[model samples]
Target chain A: MKKHHLRIPGPTEVPEQVLRAMQAPMINHRGEEFTSLFKKVSEEIKEVFQTKNDVLVFPSAGTGAMEAAIANLFSPGDLIVSFSCGVFGDRFADIAEAFGARVERIKVEWGRPVTYEIVRERISKDTKKEIKGVLFTHNETSTGVLNDIKSLREAVGDHPALVIVDAISSLGAVELNTDEWQIDVVVAGSQKALMIPPGLGLVSVSERAWKAVEDSKMPKYYWNFKNAKKSLEKGETPYTPAVSLVYALEESLKQIFDEGLENIIMRHKLLAKALREGLKNLGFRLFAQDSWASPTVTAVDISDFQGKINFSKALKNRFNITVAGGQEKLKGKIIRIGHVGYVDELDIINVLSAIEMILADEELFGKGVKAAEKVFNEGVEV
Target chain B: MKKHHLRIPGPTEVPEQVLRAMQAPMINHRGEEFTSLFKKVSEEIKEVFQTKNDVLVFPSAGTGAMEAAIANLFSPGDLIVSFSCGVFGDRFADIAEAFGARVERIKVEWGRPVTYEIVRERISKDTKKEIKGVLFTHNETSTGVLNDIKSLREAVGDHPALVIVDAISSLGAVELNTDEWQIDVVVAGSQKALMIPPGLGLVSVSERAWKAVEDSKMPKYYWNFKNAKKSLEKGETPYTPAVSLVYALEESLKQIFDEGLENIIMRHKLLAKALREGLKNLGFRLFAQDSWASPTVTAVDISDFQGKINFSKALKNRFNITVAGGQEKLKGKIIRIGHVGYVDELDIINVLSAIEMILADEELFGKGVKAAEKVFNEGVEV
Candidate 1:
């Protein structure tokens, strides 16, 4: 049997146990068994999200949760300050715009993170806090830039505006202290770092978010926060959820907790470091600088070889390693390698080894995999 | 080994093949494998939807698809006539109202079907054709009433109002010719007669509906029809879909085709008829009259044993047979026995015997199971 691996940012490699979890028979969503399972999963999800507030799960993509945050926190014409580094950040801001919000974006170069200096400079202008909310992409998977949401929170500095973070590709892989950072809402997807499929969208709401939700005048039914919260109290969802995916989440959370959150985060960091160093050793430049590079995914700049070589496609055809090509303006300029949920040190080495084989450059190819292995040897237990 | 069965109306029992299908490892959503799979699924879905139009699949419950119909078809403050007979019907209207539609509900008794007479009577009064859309629940799972959409279509003859139907529970179980009925949009769920788990929400859109979509001024992002349509051309979703559920759909659609659509519809009818007759013979009254009784689920009037003896809970506790209790005002008044999606005559007989055992009344106990068997024996195949 041929083996295939997903090295894309989301819908990462589901473990054998987690995949088996999806094979479990369907259960009643409103019944005792599912109620208990949901309650358990809901509680466990918070540990990974690092939130004190309840995480409301929906049966849509991370984008749905992003839309939910926009629709629930503010009304039309609400002023929102969007700090966008790359594609996902732009999408979050775009969602706010689509919902009729007047978004003033603090745009940065694609390969750079949205620093707190720019945030403070803009937020300080809002004396009355006319900006009702702020949107930030914690991890811009497209450009491998991970903005520091904790620092951004401090930049807001007791401003009444809600701080919403799109942690779709970063949550669980990295630390996102929702309550500690005073982040009003954090939207996440099941597929990214949760080791589940792409159906379930999780959103953690703090006390501040609930207050904003009450004042929101937006019209919503399916993604309505009040209905989701009301049902979460009963250990149920307002509508039928992805029951099988929830089962998978239960199993994946068990693996995550077994590995320990701190260990998992460290593992991600080590793997990303190894991959990045290995890529650089192979004569590849990274899109984001080391200071802002994402732990879950790495964007390898291929601008030098854009028309001359096809990096991601070569890996896909030769080794069955599915990596993502760039999007929008970054298209054909960079190749993204995902090392998120269920990926280990060996996975990084294998991908690096494959890249080396694909390139077949005598001087550069042999050095990359060895460099990745060295990182694994120097790091903690793989 | 405990075998728990789901006999709910929405999240019906998934087949073994479909459950196993969910075990397949995650793949990249934007990859070629997924593109081909999506393309094949998109084509196969139309056969069941009975339309030439593209069926947009969302990673949410059927309620989300219902909301998508409301959000994508008509703008805010548009006049809509919602013919509501049950909770879901009322919910469709509520979603329209939540989206700022001027909804005028033609309400009927909970157990009664929304007849053509009621639709025509209301439609004729709107001579100016101010009614932008008409919302109908083809099969009200809450009351086990199946309204005749073809008749309703005739009643709205020559009217420009878009006819939207919530066929979540009835689409695959019963016969629905989307093109023949000229239904502008029909929302369906995966867990029903598709024999998949509760995740995917599918909607078939007509060309007329696309024109309305072009003119729709409603602010939407996740459920935006234009984005979905554009992506459909590329055999991809605008966002990450429930990949496992889509895999399950492929397997389940194969099952659907192998059994043949007409045979599947007949089987659902046979199973429902036997369950209904068995329950009737056991001294249980039906909620919906025989004239408009649904062929997917049967509602047994349990008001007689509401407080005295819990029917659905007793079935669950003693037999591990999960059935649905009534919702909203009908709570504790009826018990719904779902016979759609992977259910056969044997399932009906087994559930009937369990109900008889739970009743334990000498006059009503033995006859129910035997009556179910007679229906099965007279039927062509289980």
Candidate 2:
């Protein structure tokens, strides 16, 4: 079989230019050239985050940025409200618990977006202002759901708790107004919608979070926002950054700005609609609620396969098509097809045809690739 | 001016193979293909680390691994012995303190190595068992000094305190016996002697350090040893790894193993000695003491230039030779030339001639590039 197309959530397919940008000659971290590069990149990153406050860049995955947000925002034993819908959400609770924080999870079912009412209820229960923060994933990739962070923040009015959103898979693919949503800490990675590799984690902070940093008792060094902010003031990193990746990011962000934020989000939305409609017409059920579905990934319930159709395994082994499987309780019950950055209608049609052929080969579906091709042709026009 | 040769501590010149490796198609984090890839890479990383213990891969610089070490080892109000000789040593102290660890520093002058005598004195003074751990940098890149870690470990004797070593700049370039030296925690990064770009950081833990992880109370999520270990058991990262970097690391490790670790270390030593001898023959003053000089980098006083030469800046501007400047208080005083991974006699000569040209350009020294060429020819057998 030929090399499989990557249709999973992230490390998303990086554009060729971004890859070439990383191939540039290395620079000394302390040199004037690097300082200028870092400063421009840092300032440009703020435009994407839509925040005037400091944005710390780390050389880890989105998870590392999540850890940094927790480490730099609160002391040990501080009460934190974690909104849970899927694996990433649960991860926040686990991270907070490991850090000695009392994590109160406002749980929602997997594939379902967490309502603002639950968050409000959790905050109201903490009358003593002991809840230092509320943690939420803006986009839950595992479940293909996007939480309404704007409404959640509005619901959290007058509360002393800071709102932290994990925008790992959604940042560039969706509309994320960090300042508008009053997101105290919004964390993202270079992978996913940013159309780059998975090494760089970014966290944009608000003034409120900066104040919390002063009193945070957790131990942090490499991911220290304070040190990063100070060095950023001089257009540098406290230590040698992932210089190659930083160079790649500079190029990626340039493309992002050129496409414009609204246009990017609209592209994802339109692509997501096309994918969902195609799957539905082929008798598949989407995992996420219609209103809350994520534009990045579309998780479809594939339980109706009649014969020997192992949908997830078949796509990979037969067609060299790499898609995601169900996580935790949903394992083997769903297949997540991605339509993220650097992907277009042609790519989507190809993936859809691959899936169609596999399903027909197993004697589960008979319409073949024509339905997917028609959908793509129609979808591209819109 | 042409592009500067990155001959400082890290973010070294990436080999073409490693760069090509990073050009692979991105895989979804939750996909079956990634799981297979993740497992293969994780096990291979273990082979490089030479540990049965899980190796956690992070996407930051070496500092991220250092932060991971701090967050996973000690808790608030815990006392730890920190040995300081250079900027990285100073960093360990800062990180420990940031995590609420009471750091007692055994200070050594910059450009000097820490002696067992100092370690013994510090260990003897902590009679109350208040010291929770000791942090040391295996090769202080800033000073071009290597400490006697085994001797320091012997000084600790039966102490319960953990021994952590920051082996960032030394790992692939210098010989390190993490298991044999009773090092509780050892940290390294990809960009230094590893001949890869600056994205991944690696850490290995002894059984003793694993036990200390249970007592660690600092806030952690992405860097959580427990979570990473759990995922590593299945040959996957807890979160999305920098997949492309891991691919690069896999190729890098193959080269390292093919050359053999001992040979790699020996090559570094021979090159370092030859560089020093050539500098000495050229009437250059060595900043680091002979006994404690690092095999990776050679720090020189450049006192002969007095106020006449800005060695670091001049070399970069004139010949695109990027040597390291004196950091912190050592600024404008010393020039550090690193001959680490993928380096040969030619690279040494290239740097040496650049230095000689800079000196001659200022008329501080006679035309020494030709003399240095002869000295390199005689001194370096490689």
Candidate 3:
């Protein structure tokens, strides 16, 4: 049996320490032991989110956090501008539509980020300020594109509408100043960049979002923001949280703070560049343009293989590197290599060397690895 | 440092093998490895539920699963009969009400089960068949009462309204025949008798529940049963599940099947009875009537102490055993001792001995322990 390499967009490689922390015997969630830990985590996660507002933790997947953003902030028939470019972006829009919101979808091309002007133009057209909110996916992992949310927020231009960002795959490994950007809500999860498994869905709420939440009439229970906030006041969650995951989060937040956010961000950026540059050097075309390419995941157009090799299968079966296939319309057309969370430059080099081995004909033995090493050498300050 | 004993109702003591399994590295959730594991767990969980129906595994706490049932089965203003006996029962009713259901709550007194006559009387009044569903908490751990669900189902008596049971704290430790009892939905959690940490909300859905899910007008995304069912068809989840918890569950379920469900139930019953008798021998009064006493958690009236000792604090401060105090109306009136998941005869004995030490009056030194030993010796056929 070969050793496995997890390179999926999420459910990424959890740190060894975090896993050990999770294995610590269960504790009473309602007691002081959990409350003290909860308060500390509640305080520390704010640094990662770069927000002073409350961060609501839920025992759910990242998509569930995105749904919480929709459920809490707006009522049915509210006008919401949904920015769509990738699978997760569409999923957010779908959740909004399901809640009976009038979603004016600004459809961006796959593998492309939505420009500030596009958001400004849409908000400008809502003459009466009828639009209640805008949903944005900061990082579209499916298409390996990261939207410039700080610029997009500026595009709203003093509109009373709330601004929500789905930063599930981007928050920790990327630079997201939630308060500085004036983001009303930022949704994230444990799987990506948090260096833990996928259970805890962390959503940050600004004063602006809470104001909207006060009057929203959506039928809700499990994701009710007010109930969660009340419990947090006592350092408790409204319901039973995933206790083991929270333990993992405490240790993970420690590791994240230890690394320092800026260095972590740089490490992700350099690793992504190494992977993309290495793949490009091997004649594989990159899916997203270099300008808006995600710092976490990179997509490679599968046409370069000429159907001679199933990249995902070969990587898994032979190399033991579990890269991802594209989703929805991009299925079978591209391969997505994720370098989020606990991934390092060496992991990228290992993947590249294996890819070279799989696609070797002649003169390609060390081409990809050489290109990756060059990028890592020229870059990577931390 | 004193050794810690987690004795809360849930987030119970996870077994060593399960903890070891969770420490295994994360894997690609979309890959064959996870899919095979998903299929295996899905199939095995039905045995635990004793149902032939599809069990939708959600990455959430027990309350979240209750929310799923309410969101998927009934629309706004749908009539639902909620039977409330304790905190969790009231919580189930609150969830229904939050979803805009016209909840007709049958309030059974705390420390007592909802009698079959009460259920029959409630259903008998709904001659128009307007009652869409009846929510039942099979075990009211908050009050240490176990409602007889099989008899209660007979009270429903061919009524078309769906019967949903919250078997969160009772399922793995008690006998529950979901299909045989004709329950439309059964909600459970990982932390209780499953011998794993919290994070997973396991729900079994009958064919009838699926039909209601199709026609229900409630808006849902994260807890959408249809989406979960579709993903299960391909041996995947609608979103990234708590992958590590599922690993724990796979191992835990293996241990559960090896122990046999009947044997597990007997172990729980004996432990609860031994603990109750031991406490009673020391002049402590069990809150619930002996007839309906829960086989998981037991509530002892605080009055038994004559206000001489703080039982919960003393237990923790001295022995490091974390027992829960009462909730809401019962707060300061009772002490809840959780004897669920991974508990055996010795755990009960240790707790009894600690209580005896805390209330040592020389004459009471080994009274509780002796009474507990007598119960264990005579009982515990398994």
Candidate 4:
């Protein structure tokens, strides 16, 4: 039996050092040791978030932070503009609606990126200043599409409405400037680009978003941004934080900062480029548009498979590898291989080799191993 | 420097094996690898929770699930019964109020156990049937008191109100039967007795609680128990769970079951007994009632040193050991030495030895080291 490896996008692979850092004994949250650690980690998280504004670290998944951003920033019946491209995008809309906020969705095709025109049209059409916020996903992991955040920010220029960006998948993996992009509320998770386990939700808030938080009337408690901010002022969390995960995150971010954010982005871009080229060389067409393809994951159209062959399930069954399947409507039609986090050229080669075998079994590849070798040799220009 | 150890209760020592388990590469949440892992973890968690019901795991702290238990089971304006014994108990009330619940708190003295008499009085008084649930903490870590949950259940026998327990610190350390205890909802965390890192909030629901959730009108999204239950049925989470924590928890639970729940409780009891005897021999007095003393932690009264010393901060600074100080009005007035989770005779002896030095410094210990030796020799019966 072969040991399983994670080739999935968001969770990527955790480094041994990061995991070791998390093995520290638990400390009292309100105690002095944790207070110092809490303060330092809060500051370091802000640095990674690329914002001087206070970042609220909740011991929750990205979705929890997404819900917190919504519940604490809007009132019932308030309008929120959400762009939908895939599962997570739809989730934002569904969650906001679930909170009683009327969501105006700018629907984009599945596996397609949200362009500036769509957001511009949505914002411009709002004659009333009723839209409290415009929600966007920086990277649609379900479809592997990266929306133009800068363009969305430009379109919402000077609008009083908050610009909430779900950067759960893109944060450290891609080049994002929450400050420069004018993103009001940018949310990320630990398991993604930070190369840690899933547990912490990092939400960076701007002064503009803080104002909305003060007046927002939605019912909230545990994920209350106001309470979290109040604790942040004292460099603490009102509740017990995941100390080990925070330790892991601190180490992971140290690695990220030491490598320099630019280098981290370049590493991911290089890996993404290599994976895409390798897959294409094996006769696979990318599911996402070339210009908007996510550096974190590449979704390929494996629709040529017979009904019996679900490319997503085949990788797990035959190769002891796990990749994401198309969510909702695209289920079983595509296989998404994520090359984000601590992945490198060698990991890409290994994944591609497995893909080569799976595709060959479906008669979709000729000279399967040779094709992967050609792509690996020519793909990454290190 | 001495190696860091967590004698401060939760976020207790995460075992190396559990740490190694989480160090495995991150798997995609939607992928098959995670699906199987998620399924097994969910089942195992149910076993720990002692319920056949689904347990929803959240990325946030235990407070997140406590809040979830409230928000999902009742709507805004819904009246609920809350018991306030210490900081955490009151926090639940505060959060419920914040979420718009009309909370009726049964106030108990700090450091005092809540009685069945008080619960009966409160329930009998609420003849209006407006009370949707009764919220209480099983272990009040702030004051080292464990409420009589068994009697409290009898007091509310056959009542329509649900019983919710915040077993964050007590769950695996204490004997809690979610089914037999008639506990309608029980919320716990991955830290504490679970011996994992902080990040996951595990909530076990009773069939009765599910009915309340069905009609619950409170505004909720990420903490929605319905979404969690639905996804849990399919062996997945509604959102990306704290994946690595789940893996660590799986390993931790195996250790727990291997030790057996009854024996685990006995170990905690014996350790608490040793710690109390050690402190008493050191010329220190226990704070909470002896009968109600928590097995997880022993809170010591240092009120005698009011103007003489700030032993709270001194212990951590001088010895690099972390213990908790009294919360709220009891600040600097008491110190808590937690002897729970991966702790043994040596840990209790170390804490006792440190207390002797600190006490001698303040002239509180007339015999110093000799006093501690007597306690260490008692050797916790187990």
Candidate 5:
């Protein structure tokens, strides 16, 4: 009875209730029942986003949402500021560039967050106000770094540049006040902290972003924000949506609401703390700086280990545990352990023990477990 | 014990086996297991497409695939001929126009298929041969009309126009030989005849379309076929896929293959015949002409009925049966009964009886049942 434990940064474990909810029979997307379901789900999603802005749902992965943001809010030759600290941040910039945006990318080190000082400096230097938008990632999944969105928005101060955030791996697990931070657009995916499968891409649009959409001349049909908004007014999508995922999202949202959003965020923070302490005790170096480490995923440096590639394979083969390896330039140098949706302390403990067992080192295993327990015992007071 | 019947044109009845398959635990999409699954599903999809060309799967609705075809296969200001007979057909043209294509629309009356003569006339008139592609729908779900692709392709004889088809609701339930018909691109969705929920958009691109892609200047990121094809060669998708839907698709494909493609098409034909006969006996007229009526969805004229709005409401409220109504200009004038996906003869009989009951006419019910039974008794033989 060996159960596989999934600890990927995204596509984390989904609860059985959510899976069962998705198993329900199909419903007509254009019908009364589905309209009500659609409305309810939209409302719930907005609640999670902590915004009164329109939340548009698309039958796509997070990258699609990122593209939608660029295509809908900017026209050809529009200048934009894109901050890149990791792979996902770079991807956000790439989407903008693909749509003909002249992007001035602010590159930061892989394991560091995009500092507010750099953002302030960039926006201040743009006295001409040629930049139409600022594209950044709330949480860099590849590096497990979380940028300070509120501080970045504050730095943009009174500027017309829309703040478009890729909150794919962070939204539900972290404290993101969309409206308070004045983010023009926030792009997210279902397979991350939402505790659902990959298919649906959720985006929250502010009135300012809607204005940008109106003036935008970028060629788009499927990802057109106006069509989505119009259909959403009628409680339907412009195109057919991924119905099963919506059902699963309903169940997942129910679980989220029951636990409360604030508590969920706190739980994630505590879990990350425990996992980081465990890794530290096991003599593993943390990938990201402590100040901006993402609560959703923890990256541990494995470059010093002799069998880096073999380590992930042995963990899966021996204990049926799945963790993610570093992507791009950091490949084979780090392992990412996701503590996102549907994950709890027991799951974390199981993963820690499995890693220790794979190492076959008693002293490290004892110290790691003790460190994790100390963190867990303190409890998530928030 | 009231089991609701889903008879909409899409979001059709999914099989229990497929639903169960979707309930499986999440697997790493970038891992060996998912790579194997992805390859197997791609090959099976090609079998259903009836083509040796590449079949690209996107985690989006059918409209996304339509957008993909336009974005990848044509540059801005590229001349294209789009034949519009119904809502979906017009939508195809809209996508092309949105991408800056100068489309020559061959508009036919609603509920009628675009004839080969009209296509030939349009193509022959373009003596300059400036038209890069000819876009048409295989099955227009809005009006229950199925155009003749083979005839249309033959009409474009020695021309350089690429034959792009929207086969969202007809591919599996109709006889469409992609290679034999020389189709350049075919776009389809999962929820119609594919017996799955709404999420995946499957597009098959011939060698000709690939050439068009190389020269296309339209900007694309999310729906870029080149990136998708590149990743597919490595047994992966450029972006994360809706993994659960792929699992469900595998199960759905097994059911399709087990029953046989030819037999499935025959079943749809026979079921459609039964449904049309039943509607006819009940003093109703078919919306589409009999010669080119779609076998997947049967549209019945409801303009003369005083209780047009109440009809669908009564069907759902009283019988728990869901069917589709017409769109655009035909709304509240026609009701569409979908026999696509997992629907059978018994399901059709139940719907017919429910319609009769809603009318409160015993004589109509008896005649309808008899007409349906006569066709069902004949049995489908491929």
Candidate 6:
């Protein structure tokens, strides 16, 4: 079978080791073996999230984690400031709204990051401090923008509002100091930079978030944080967990720790830098602002291309490379190339070469490849 | 490494083919290949469910699907009747109550099944007919009892209360005609008889359930049936699905269909029968009623055995055989041997032999093995 490059923002390429780990025989979820495995994975996940707080793993997708954050921490009609810069950011707001939280969205333009100024203005404007929480997406997958979570948290200083973040596509590939940044709740998925399949939703909750959970009256059973915490104490989940995915996660976590978290984040940064430069050399305008460009995914403006959908289709059908199209309003106007999880510099090169072949632009291809090489040669530390 | 028998009710032993299927490389969830695979698997799942209605798959454990059923079909304060027979049944009621639904429970004895008489009397006595839905467990894993869902549905007699069943531990290993029985919604888990790991929650929604969903006011976003239905139109899930689990499900469904659903259910029946007879020969009484005993798991009373916990632990530690101990009220009183999902007569023999060895009774071991052999040789058709 022809190899297909999966370049979606999340559900990034899973490594062979991780896939093999998933093939391990199923074990009894409530047994000692599983309990140990669950505990180990939970601890490893907490380390990755850079938090000393409790981390809950659910057998669900990232959106479910997003929902859990809202459902577990906020009651109906509770006010929250949602910083929406992209689709995923908007989804956080949507989930809060769906659960009856009154979401006051600080809607940034598409392809822009949630700036500290916007967060400060939103929180400070709430003089009565009616807002019970602040929701932000650390890495906006759709627009390929990484928000300054630390700055956002600082902006909310002593406001008594819980700070919740969607770090689905960023946790493993980007720098997220959950504890240092005072993030009350941080949500992530196994499918992204964790290099596993889409099944597990990982969330870390601070003492402050626990307090909110105590006061929260949102109707929740499946996503109950308290129940998950109780089960976690026993080294088990409240319900049946995705055993295979947990196995995959264990292997991936081992690999990540072996490689070191700092190295993984650096690798993502270097590869993302090269990818952005390569795309620019190939006559594509970068969608996200340079300073806040995400190291996980890079959005490119393909509006100049005739039939952007056809271009994306050709990239997949003809070249065996799958990339993401713009979601919602940005559909057909941009294409996204993900460089998270198991991806490396060579993978970026192959994607660029495939795009070159599809566009039949040999001259642009050479320039793009050279630009990427130059960036790699510069030693990638910055 | 010594192979271990995973005898849990839901996450029973997965077949090698299914495990290998899960090792397949990741693909784009929104792409054509995934769409085709999604459609094919969805159809096969419906076929297994014996339903003409829409079956939605969630990246969650069965409890998530149970929550979806309550959160989607019933609004806050909506009256529902929950027939509690065992732990899983109680959980369904708890989920409904958690979501703010008023659950009028028909609480039966732990090992007793929800009989048609109980359901009939409950519904008939409610002259006001305020209950909007009836929740029942087709197979209660905790107590190893199989409720009479068909008779219960008949007892409802067009009361406008939607009949929802939890078939998590019984879906594939037992016979369930969703359409014929007119179940409004049926929830299942992949880890059970589907022969996959625990992650995907499959739910079949009848047309009547759709009407209830439309009028329901409970908060939901990630588990929204309407969004899931919309995505199903495009042969996708509303949120990212557990892709590897879906691949495993595809293989498992193929194996199930190839074996024929009737033969599969018969295999479970035969194994369950052998296990029960074997346990009885060893001087253990069956916990569940003979007529309502589940074919998936057999609950054996171990009150005669001192240190039941040590006996169970020895079975696992010494013989590499794992069986579920009684949960909640039944703790230390019974041990459950799962004969569902990829289990056969030999597996039953192995478990019985292990138990006999743990008990250190030669006479009991000989009698148990003989009883199992006799049942197997009798052709198991009955």
DockQ of each: 0.01, 0.01, 0.01, 0.01, 0.01, 0.01
How many clashes would you count in candidate 6? Answer: 0
Q: List candidate 4 stretches off by more than 4 Å.
A: A361-382, B1-382
Candidate 1 all-Cα RMSD: 26.1
Error of 6 at A329 (Å): 79
Model 3 chain A scores worst on lDDT over the 10 consecutive residues at: A360-369
Question: For residues A1-382, what per-residue lDDT tens digits would candidate 3 score against the true structure?
Answer: 1335798888898876887899788899999999999988998999999999999999999989998999999999999999889888899999999998999888999989999999999989888999999999999999999999989999997998899999999999999999998999999999999989999999999998999999898878999999999999899998998999999999999888887999899989888887888788778899998889999999989965656889899888755789999998899899999999988655776577667656754355445655665666566742
What would the per-residue lDDT of candidate 2 be over residues B1-382, giving only the tens digit for each residue? 0323678877787765777888788888777877787777777766656567767888788889999999998898899889989999999899989988888887898878888888888888878878899998889988899988888888888878899999889887776777777788889999888889888888898888988899899999978999988887776777778888877887888777787887788778767876776677567889897788998998998756768888887877755678888888777778889888867544664565456545453332212323333433343253
Give lDDT: candidate 2, residue A223.
80
Candidate 4 chain A worst ten-residue window by lDDT? A364-373
Q: Which residue pairs clash in candidate 6?
A: none
CAPRI quality level assigned to candidate 5 from its DockQ score: incorrect
The digit string of per-residue lDDT tens for model 6 on B120-187 reads: 89889879879899999999999999988889899998898999999999998888999999999999
Docking class of 1: incorrect
| Cα lDDT computed for each candidate against the true fold | 0.85, 0.79, 0.87, 0.79, 0.86, 0.85
Residue-wise C-alpha lDDT for candidate 1, range B1-382, written one tens digit per residue: 0136578886877776787888788999999988899889989999999999999999999999999999999899999999999988999999999999999988999899888899899889888889999999999999999999999988998899999999999988798999988999999999899989888999999999999999998879999989998998898999999999999999999989988999888887777877887788878899998788999989989888866889888878755789999899888888898888877644665576567556665455335655555565566453
- Show where candidate 3 strays beyond 4 Å: B1-382
TM-score of candidate 5 versus the correct structure, residues matched by position: 0.52
List runs of model 2 lying over 4 Å from the truth. A1-4, A361-382, B1-382
Residue pairs whose backbone atoms clash in candidate 4: A26-B11, A59-B59, A59-B60, A60-B59
- The ten-residue window of minimal lDDT in model 1 chain A covers A361-370
Could you tell me how far off, in angstroms, the CA of residue B111 lies in candidate 6 after the best superposition?
0.9
Interface RMSD of 3: 28.3
- The most accurate candidate by lDDT is 3
Model 1 / residue B90 / CA error / Å: 0.5
